[model samples]
Target: MTDVDLTADPLHDSPALREFFGDSYDRVARFAVMLADQGVLRGLIGPREVPRLWERHILNSAAVVPFLGEGTIVDIGSGAGLPGMVVAAMLPERSVVLVEPMERRTQWLFESAKECGIDNVTVVRGRAEEVDEVVEADVITARAVASIDKLVKWSAPLLSPSGEMVLLKGRSAGDELERGKYVLRKHGLVGSVHEAPTLEGLEATTVVRLQRQG
Candidate 1:
C-alpha cells in the first residue's frame, strides 16, 4: 500500500490548523493520511470508517498535547500511534514509548516514526503486563486499550510517583471508571475522568487521570 497524498490543498494551507499545530502540523497530518492510505488502519478499523484525517484523527490526537508534561510518555497498546506518535510529532520535547505486543503493529509504529522524522518515539514489542521494568514516566496514555480496571493493574508500575495516567475512552467512560474502582483503590491510585472535545459525532471522549498516592 502507498502512503496518503499529504500535499493536498486544504490541509497544506489552513491557517487555523497551522496555528493550532505550529511547525509540526504538516508532519502529523501527513502521518495520519499515510496510515489511512497504507491500509494500516484499515486492518483494524476498516477503510470506510476512517474519520476525516486532519480534523478527526490528527486534531483529536493533538488535543491531548496540552495535558502532557515534559518527560517520558508510555502509550499502552499503541496500535498505529493514535495519540502517541501524534503527540511526539507536536511535542518534540517529550519522549514517547509505544508499547504494543503485536509484531505487525509494532513494526508499523517504528516505520511511521521514521517516516515522520520523529526521533523521540520508541516502539517496544511486548505486552504491557509481562514486561516488568522500572521505567517511570511523567505520563502514561492508553487509547481504547482496555477496561480501566485492567489498565490500572497493567500500568501501575510504569508510572512514577507523581506520574499521571491519561486513558482515552468513549461514552462508556463512567461505566469503565466504576468498574475499575476496586482496582484503582487497590493500586493506591486516585482516579478521575475528564471530558474531551467532540469530534466526528463522537459526543464524549473521556480522559482518565490517575495519580499514585503516598
Candidate 2:
C-alpha cells in the first residue's frame, strides 16, 4: 500500500472558509494552488509551509480583511503575496499594492495576480522604505516582514494623512510593541495589538495596528 500525504491537498475547503471568502473563494483557492505548486521553487515560501497553506497563510492572511476600511492597501514585503494577494482576492473592489524587493518575487506576484484573475493588485518591486512617493497608502499591511520598530519606520512615509498600519505579527507581538514604543512615539504613532480571527479550530492571527497620534 502507498502512503498518501494529506498535506499535499492544502486547499481542502471548509464551511468557515467558504463563508468568509464568499464570492472570492475560487480566486483565492487558485492562488493557494499556485503557492503549493511553485512557492518553494520560486523561493517565496518554504517547503514546510505547503502542508498548512490554507490555515497558516491563506486564512491567516484573510483575518486582516475585516480591519481594512476604505481606500488603497499597501502590503510591504509581500513574498508569495500572503495577505497582500489574499486581500486583493477577497476584496476585489479595493486596490491592493504589493511591495517586494526581489525581482523574482515581484514576478511571482505579478504572475499570480494575473493567473488568479486578481485585477485589483499592483506589484511594486522595491524595499518598503524605498517605495515611490506617489504610492500613498490609506492602509498598510505586512506579515512576518520585520520588527515593529522597523516596520513603522518603513511604512511611515507611504501612509496618507489618516493611514494606519495593520501588521500580522506572532506570539511576541506585545513584547515587540513594548520595545517599539519609543520609535512609534518618535514617528508620532501609537500601537495596539488585536487577535484577529481565522477559522474556529485554528489559532487567531496576531495583528498589530499602528496609527498616527491624534
Whose lDDT is greatest here?
2
Model 1 earns a TM-score of 0.86
Candidate 1 backbone collisions, by pair: none
Q: Which candidate comes out best when scored by TM-score?
A: 2
The runs of at least 3 residues in candidate 1 whose Cα sits more than 4 Å from the true structure, single-residue gaps closed, are 1-13, 40-44, 198-204
* Predicted candidate 1 versus true structure: per-residue lDDT over 1-214, tens digit per residue: 3433434424444677777677887677667666767743437445553544555566666666666766789888888687889989988877888889999888888888888788899888887776658456789888877888888888888877788888777767888888888898888888777776633444445577777776
Lowest-scoring 10 consecutive residues by lDDT in candidate 2?
A: 1-10
List the RMSD of every prediction in angstroms. 3.1, 3.0
Candidate 2 residue lDDT tens string, 58-124: 9899998888888999999998898999999999999999999999899999888988899999888
Measured with C-alpha atoms, the lDDT of residue 75 in candidate 2 is 96
Worst 10 residues of 1 by lDDT: 1-10
